[model samples]
Target: MHYEKEDWNFELVVAGAGVGGISAALAAARLFRRVLLIEAGPEVGGTGVFSSVSLICNFRDSRGRPITSGIHRELFPAAYTHYNEQRVPTYDELALKSTYQQLLEAEPTLTVWTGCTVESADVENGRIQRLHLQGQQAGTVAAEVFLDATADGNLSAMAGMQYEIGREGDGKLQSATATFRVSGFDLLKLENPDIQTWPAIHSLRLELLPYYQALKDEGKTANPRQSITCFPYPDGKALLFNSTSVLGVDPTRPDSVSRGMEEGTRQANELFGAICGHPAFRQARLDYIAPRLGVREGRRITGEYILTAEDCLNTRHFGDMIAACAYSLDIHSPDGGATRLESIPGDGYYHIPYRSLIPVGCSNLLLASRCISGTHEAHSSYRIMASVSAIGEAAGVAASLAVIQRKKDVREVRPAHIRYVLQLRGQFTEGEVERIPLPASPQQEPPVSVEPNFKSNHD
Candidate 1:
């Protein structure tokens, strides 16, 4: 294939247009920094959109206080406005994709390039100097600072950064999923008509369990999941099945991911067929399987501090804290058995220090996704959308500060300044916040109108 060559320069270049990348790009652009966001896919919205993971995982502490805000709240406002513990919080993928597009387009200093991948990186000493592009658009790109929001640490790996993958003992990863959406089910036929409530959804799952168990007994399906796991959509008319566990898939291996997708799709179909046997789902229609496989765990780049499970469960705090996570340590079994979930002990959240975002020995690169330095167990917790978005936002602010302060290395960018900016942006911050005056006041995020067609039923 012939490639067109072009040259570009920007103050910040974010690789991967997922939640993390989008948050990072938007944060920097809002600060009037020229930013470029590159995605390997044909469009933005990464796993949340393409993989169809419906549930907006918990971002609240044990006391029901939200620890994740800012960009994340903007992306899923209904999650906050309609908060209810009894109801499962979820977002429509199409609605979210539209929101991402609108927010990105509104930023004058931000440029988005889809169907593009960073083929290589030029490193001098411990800093990345330039990046070579490939795919739909080819070019040589240079940036003052780079954010590896690729989710799997693709950019960091290309920059020759050291990283670890999967669990330490045997290098096993979390099971992958091929989620699907279904509609037209008879709500009244269920034991409880309100599928939006946790109790109702749990009863619905139990009601459909027999058919799935029968399928397994008959040797008709290969899915190893023990139960039916699903969440109701915001409109309450559809259900998103997050079941179907496919093990042994690694993001680094293209063939493995492709095979995983195929197997996962097969399992989805099998489970859908089984679920259709239920009285409530007799006329249910399988809308479609997600276009992309949901690969949960990936490369964790080595940063200055590697967050451990001990720190997470103990609710550890750091002097350079830049973000926080309230989600549980959720690890889907690599052997395709039961999943392990452990909640945070104290305040139900732990601080994510700024050092975890800075890769060890790297002066200009920062981790903006689940790939940030952490052990396998700890990665399972903050890998959710909420914490990753907060991490991305912090990285973006730090990167912009590095450029504005004329700092030669990212280490010089103070966490206090990042926290101060984050607080100004309506994000939750802790510890001391040092005010840093900017050339211009940061632009306030405009209010985004909720989608007219979809409405949350939560009280």
Candidate 2:
């Protein structure tokens, strides 16, 4: 048996280099904890860079308010070289990589490991005693606190942590799209005066109609080209398109995910080629494809407190609010169907409790990203980059506190302390926003409900 033994100790080991993992590393480093950021991919910026998402999702609250704060709020505008009318800024993938590198380089206590995959872990009692990692010819290394920042919650599953992979009732999740960039676009000539104008969009759509008709004639595709979603790239001369939707991609299954990525890429090129022949895009050229597949849904580990759809509509505020989210439910179907709830009403603000970040029955483990506690409906809103970044901040801070206090259970740490640190670091809070004045309540009796439909899938 060729077994190599090595021991590496760090205050925190953050698995995955996505927004959540990166934020965790940044936050933990600020708290003076030694953090090892491990990523399965060869490069950083998990989906942000690899998937080439042009802009950050709704950074503001329901009332068109900007809720992100702390390192995330600062990192937002910095990630973009320019912000157009789309509300989200256009991000250069290369620039984003450099930004993450620069930000991490500024942290003395931060160590980054690209192409590193965590195979398994050893958990004693509630705390994770050691985590085994392998990558780029490097053997295994251990750590004190292990964060399951992987978008798929890979680490949590390996540690025997309970989680759900898809929607409970329907056994489905929002569709996944493969994104690609097109070059040779003329920002100066394009009629899109603003990001929303998309005047050239209709032109591009018309150009793709003939191609779609041909495909349908040949029995290649059932969907038309008008169903595509295009966003302006940072350079303004380029357009990033997300038209292909891969359904039934179980994130936990590597084979399924790999297949989804391959199909998505193929679909991207097919769309790109169709657009290239158009009058508006006749001069266009294919820019680049994503290095990582864009995954819209995955295993969402059930936590101690799961935020629900009702909570979102109510704009409920928890006593231990660690962060806030305002984005509405955006569920895209694999059948090329897209659904979006533009607003959630009620001031467009909702609180993310500290309890949601900490997993139930597990110690020394924190979930960031889409895996954080919430119903499928709630996950749609919370899965956005800004909200995930906030969740990462909360988890990172909580981990730092756990290490400093030598606490075993993550729940042992006080929520107030986490809130205090987040506030000090400039994280937004409901307290900061003054509640709108409401009319006085009348002294009237209310009737009680005789029937209750409390059996919910979230339970």
* lDDT by residue for model 1 (57-132), tens: 9899999999999999999998888898998899999999999999999998898999999999999999999999
> Looking at model 2, how many pairs of residues clash?
2
After superposition, the stretches of candidate 2 with alpha carbons farther than 4 Å from their true spots are: 1-5, 78-88, 137-140, 187-218, 222-226, 334-336, 431-459
Best by TM-score: 1
What's the CA RMSD of model 1 in angstroms? 7.1
Model 2, 1-459: lDDT tens per residue?
Answer: 123557777789999988899998898888777788989888879888888877566666544557776777656674333434434355677777887889988887788888878988887787677777777636665666778899878888888877776665777877777888887764454444344334655555544567655655676653333365677765566777766677777877889889988888877777777666555577888877777778888877778898888888788999878888878877676444556565667778788988888777788899976788888788888888888899998889888777766667788776666665677677876442211111122222122221222222123
- How good is model 2 by TM-score? 0.86
Model 1: what TM-score? 0.95
Model 2: colliding residue pairs: 61-65, 62-348
